[model samples]
Target: MNAARTQTDRTTARSPRPRAVLAALAAAQFTVMLATSIVNVALPQIRDGVGLSDGATTWVVNAYGLAFGALLLAGGRVGDLLGRRRVLVAGLALFALASLAAGAATSPAALIAARALQGLGAAAIAPAALALVMESFPAGPARGRALGVWGAVSGAGGAGGVLLGGALTEAWGWPWIFHSVALATAGVLVAVVVCVPRPPGGRDEGPAGRFDLLGTTTVTLALTGLVWGLTTARGAGWTDPRVLGALGASVLLLLAFVVIERRRPDALIPPRLFRTGRVAAGNVLMALLGSVWIALFFFLPLYQQQVLGSGPLATGAGQLPFAAANMLGSSLAPLVARRIGARATVTGALLTEAAGLLWLSRMSADGSYLVDVLGPSVLVGLGLSVAFVQLTAFAVDGVPGKDTGLAGGLVNTTRQVGGAIGLAALTTLAGSVTAASAHEPLREALTAGYRSAFSASAAVLAAAALLALFLTRAGAPPAVPPAAPAPRPLTPEPSRAP
Candidate 1:
């Protein structure tokens, strides 16, 4: 009770310019999300230009995702201890510097290293920005609207990454993609400095607490090992010694993390968080949802380019329909949530996703874009967009303000981990099908593999829908308005820089 009061005390002075704060937060989100997919279209050029073998090339993407997912929980904890705005600025600085390094890299090793640094920065920025948004807008109509815009930017940034990457790579070169990201991030950084107001203690004051070192180390390594093993399993085979060892070690480390968290005074993820049915169920469904969305982006490009013989630029442009639908859905999510409630909205969206994936599975070796792809892509995009917004609000709802950052980190980490695992599983399934169909024509074999993967993804979504129906709780707590202000101790003005 005292802790809750202390948290309420901390956020008493609401930022007067909520719109500016929302815009800055959304732009910050877009900047990090763009990095997630900007390099995807440029992967081929990166591999060739950096003299990387096919095997090593995957790391260019995997390294960033792995590091980002692994460190997210720790990053959120850090933000909770430090101020969210301060952590956000620090994260932006790191991300921009890493982008510079990535743009300048001439070797594969340097590129991969720089990508990992970018992931670390992203791990910090994503959760802090989210927490800041939640704090800035008092929960009610204002908060719902802010979250709607926030979700739209998150979805659009990811979908737009493909289009932007293609244009930049085709016009200039692969390095230019990173350079562009660096510039955009710098712009957002400046907006953040000017637009985001400091909290009552002038941003320097934070909740006095000890960092949970033991819990942090254990959870970070456990997630890293798990993500590494799953990502490598597609190429290495599940039975390979290295893959088996990593999986086994991850399991042991996770147990250790659980044990450590139970005993630690300042747990990285408090054990009681799981007791909240909403948080637990939200995280689980988010994982399944993440897997499907990530795999869709991954496999759809393959189908477009390899099967349809489209160029990279055309393939990226093809996703514009999905992006459009996603933005439309995001804009409508708050209304839907208000009408039917968050849980039902999410359940309905998941079912819609299943239906869309099932439609997509109807594709043949020679499929028409309009009938076979576009219609289903639009459905999937809209459904996933609504799901993303509702699920995000549901996950952190009812949690104390102090722990909202951790909740955000937890949900995002699960999503990333789920994506990695799902992609690997589906990739292996497709590889096996392709090998088995080796007797058929190459195009037919590839189509069969992709079709099977899409079917599997649809099944996953249906299962997730069922889980949402049964496990997810209905309605969130009413948003607590900020407390009235009292005179705060004098401190130095917040630094615009770290």
Candidate 2:
């Protein structure tokens, strides 16, 4: 009895507390997302402080995104192979160091380089953290609830970054944004070390195979080229030879990646994974969702600050209603999914968001926040939160345990890539519309441009809603097959005869 009691104590000690694990993972996810948007409000100050030109100012944001998106696949795979805890710890260390470097930098080059490094760390952190969440929770109400929390934090991070950035920049200048992230990241790292448990058999117990170096290289370069080309097009125009060349090279590299994945036994992304229809369809919908989501954050702030003449603090504060609504929707998503099914929930959410965007597109130059922004913001926030949760569930729904990291990486990659492309395209369109309306008042012209982008985003979301209808049927069961009935024993027949 003493031995058995001792063994139970040992098992209990070894097992990680679920709440602690969830908190650590969620904190990690929030930090990575915070890095993405925290700098937007501080960009002008950063540009002046670091002597950045207009072009260089833009790179301060794009550099992080490009690196993050490009390396996510490799980062996720590395976590899966090398150990999630190990990769997560390393990523947190790197992210902290990079944030310090960024904060201390006096030159544009140093700052940009540090931001890129931060992105690399973020790439590793996001997927590993998400995979750990999946690993920790079994599928059912528990996982659904966990994912709802994930979705809430993820959505909150975007808005929260803006709110925090504005406050930090206002109180202690722009460098404090980086400094704050570093400090928070260090705390999260410590929590992860204490709370997160290693897998059985040790930290290195992954599939035994050579790393797919060729596939990794090809895909990374391809994503880099694609993002670079799109980012350049926003400022340099699509016809620029540099942009054209980058796009062309990216296409070729992507084709090569496809070929390499098919031929290689240890591919970065197995071709067979696409055979799962949900995976493919889910990613497509996620891309469309991302296109609108990213642009919404970008344009909303500009509209508040530039068109409405709001200060940075006020602009950030204005997003509270939206953020609150988003959190509420995220918390409610699982309950709604249980009632209506994930597919139908996603479809309804998309349509709801589209309606909100359509309403936003009708904003006037002389509009008030309550009339023009608040109501629509609530609608969009609710819809966006729910759609994000359902779509995330769809993407990783039937993936194998070993490839959970890969699945996380793929979903993240599509969203980031789609955001980049959509931002560039929408920015260009808005710029053109604004220029064409030169005869109007400056505020009016700007409003028109913003309105156009909102309308376009609404159309995109509508299309996604339509696509969701065909992709997954309502009330469809999980991909797991039903268990077979047990066989009857021969002795049972003799007993019946007797």
For model 1, give the 10-residue run with minimal summed lDDT.
Answer: 489-498
Cα distance off (Å), candidate 2, residue 87: 0.7
On TM-score, the leading prediction is: 2
The digit string of per-residue lDDT tens for model 1 on 1-498 reads: 999677655654443366777788899999887898888877899999889889888898899999999999989889888877888899999999999999999998999999999999999999999887776665656667777887788888887888898888899999989999999999999999887877655644446677899889998999999999998998899999999999999999999998988888889888666654377777888999999888888888888878887777887898899989888888888888777767778889999988999988889888867777899999998999988887777667666777777887998898899999999999999999989999998878998898889999999999998888877654534222123244232222332200
Clash count of each predicted structure = 0, 0
276-394 in candidate 2: lDDT tens per residue? Answer: 53777778899999998989988998898888887777778888888898899998988888877677789999999999999999998999888899999999999999998888877
lDDT of each: 0.83, 0.86
| Residue 62 in model 1: lDDT | 92
Query: How much is the lDDT of residue 157 in candidate 2?
Result: 90
